[model samples]
Target: MRTKFFIFIFTGIIFAGGLLLCSNIKTKEIQFEPRQEFSNEIKISKTFKVKPGYKLIVESDIADVSILSHQNDEVDVNFYASGSSKYLKDLKVDFEEGEGTLTIKVKRKREFKFFNFLSEWGIEKAELKILTPQNINAEVKTAGGDAHCEGLKGEISISCAGGDIKLKNHTGSARLSSAGGDIIANDINGELEAKSAGGDIIVRKLSGSIVAKSSGGDVKVELINAMGESEISTAGGDVIISAPSNLNAYVDLNATGGDIEIDFPLKLEKKNHDKLKGWIGDVKTGTKIKASSSGGDIEFRIRKGEI
Candidate 1:
């Protein structure tokens, strides 16, 4: 069901701007047209004093997007477009008054060309900036672009198709997913569930439960202090973690094709399998630490006297 939903979203994005897809352009037939306008910057600023109970949904195919929270209850959006004018005309920003949600989208025409056509269309990048309240339940989707968020206090869901994903200084339940892009997050204060398909994943300074998985990238996790359970997995990269010295929990480490190294104050009682067990110092630590890898080595290290 989830996969179906993702498929629908992807389809909607491909058809977003109401533009038709072009057939393959032969490289020999491609010509640089000086008459075709190629660059533009469009900015939009709007404010919404939303009521206490409502959800905000934002969708885009933007080159890049950043969403941050502020002290007030209003939202301001600034969007820029740099591309073929024929394509930019289809992009639109939608919003409503009263208690309705906000949806932002960019519609671009897909261009296909034969071999050597890549030389004609140079690199084009656009950036969109969004600012909203600190407490908002929102979902963001971007294709061929980066998505970033910070200082959020409610549920956040972000997905990217082919760019980096970043979350900074957020304090709420989050669901982050990406394909063909790196993910970097930090300063989380609630449950975090993140997945990546073909890039690196890094999370630091989390104080809540975490469920992180990656398919083709390295995974790095660092916790200054934690108060919840964690389950992290990776299939094709190294897994590294750093935890507090006075950590507490039932730790589990597994690696299919890698080495395992853990630094704890005390040794865990062996589990009789190809794994190690025991406690660092006191068995009353509050949380459990578990690290696993499939094709790399693992290391678990302790700070100092915390054992």
Candidate 2:
């Protein structure tokens, strides 16, 4: 009993230490950003000298974030706020600039334990927008607001707790997720990993391998010319995948509470009411295509007018 009690005490001490380390124990010099884009919005904007190979990281506590590509070599950070500037006093903007990395963290100051609950009761609404060169890698995170990353030609990752996520025109591997909101991925040319905890996922014009999933909503994927090994699944909603009719692929689809539908002339290997295993073309030279659902239908079809 004594040993177990001591172990539990030690574990709790470590956990509490981690929590304190995450917030309220700060000691660093930082910077805040943006410039006004409209009359009713207060903005502070700044530009940083950066190279093409530098890594960019951003964390927005409760603000929506938009990342876009710029023509110049430097990076631009713009922050906009609505309502009184007095609440700005409770915001912390931290910047860490090194020779190879630039990290920007923006969040409300959590001075004490009750600071967040009290501050968010009537605080200013804000947003963060970033403009950087097209060749830099980036990781963006948001607490509960939407995140959009566009025209990035390098590895990009984004996550949101409870807002929508959009990735457009990216040329490198991308990772995207949302806790309770939808995801839209368009015009991507690389491998992708996208998921949603409780919302739908829609993908279009993808040219590489993909793994897209939804825990409690629908999933739809529309691909471009040349494909790769792909997996699309959902836990509680429908799944629809459309591709070129002549692509080389081995298809496998399953559904628990609904039917599985297909349009391609597949070489049927196995078929039943709740599952299907087949080949779209020569599987030896093709990729694997898999789709599943727990409580909805699964449809594998060719793109409209591609018949």
Candidate 3:
């Protein structure tokens, strides 16, 4: 009996030691160190003269882009490039100009077979800042970086594969999408459509029609002025809407696995715990707002006077 007890104690000690070693390994794997140095850095600046209503197009593989409106009729392009020594040596920016359009593209001199794997470690980054006329139409595309634009009176389209998108204080229509990042738009005056496959979407002070959808994140919108219709949905997140106190619109809210909460008084056309169909004020305007969530709650409220 004593030998059996000794054997059991030894086995227990060995098992505990193995578990402790694994815990240490996991902690080390999650620990991160800040990067304090880069092997290469490059800056390029160019200016292009164009008409007032010219079109600006930009494409990049791994760069964050910022496009803004300026008073001048010329577009100023500035590129700030930095990465490892090998990546910096191969980076290139190409520019082309047509009758009423300007195009800028960033490319690499030689393709690295393992660039996709290395990029996950954040070994390189390039950022572009473009300033154009206030009324120029803009289109921007990036494979792995954020995109931002503001103060343009023409239509704008932006897409990013692995980063956020932001549009602010613009009078033109906008269509934006991201594969794995959030989207935010504020003070927009025209039609807006935004979608995210794996992140949240928030829009405030909107004056036109809006359609926002997300597959794995929340959807929220605050209407400053309702000119048309609005529809927002999410598959795995909450939906929240805020409107003015005296707004006249029909609202329909639904949640599949959660509650529907409305913090304002409504004239009920239909009512239930998980679904609500009502009008904020008179339904004479025929304006409609719909919000739905598949696996989360829905909240519709009246905006405070501060909004």
RMSD of each: 14.6, 13.9, 6.3
Candidate 1 residue lDDT tens string, 37-117? 666545667776675435667676555889888777778877776556654564566655535566666544454335433
Per-candidate clashes, comma-separated? 19, 6, 0
Candidate 3: tens digits of C-alpha lDDT, residues 15-78: 9999999999988866578666567788999998898878889898778999988888788999
Better of 2 and 3 by TM-score: 3
lDDT scores in order: 0.74, 0.85, 0.87
Candidate 2, superposed: residue stretches over 4 Å from native: 1-42, 84-86, 111-118, 305-307
Worst 10 residues of 1 by lDDT: 114-123
- lDDT score for residue 258 of model 3: 91
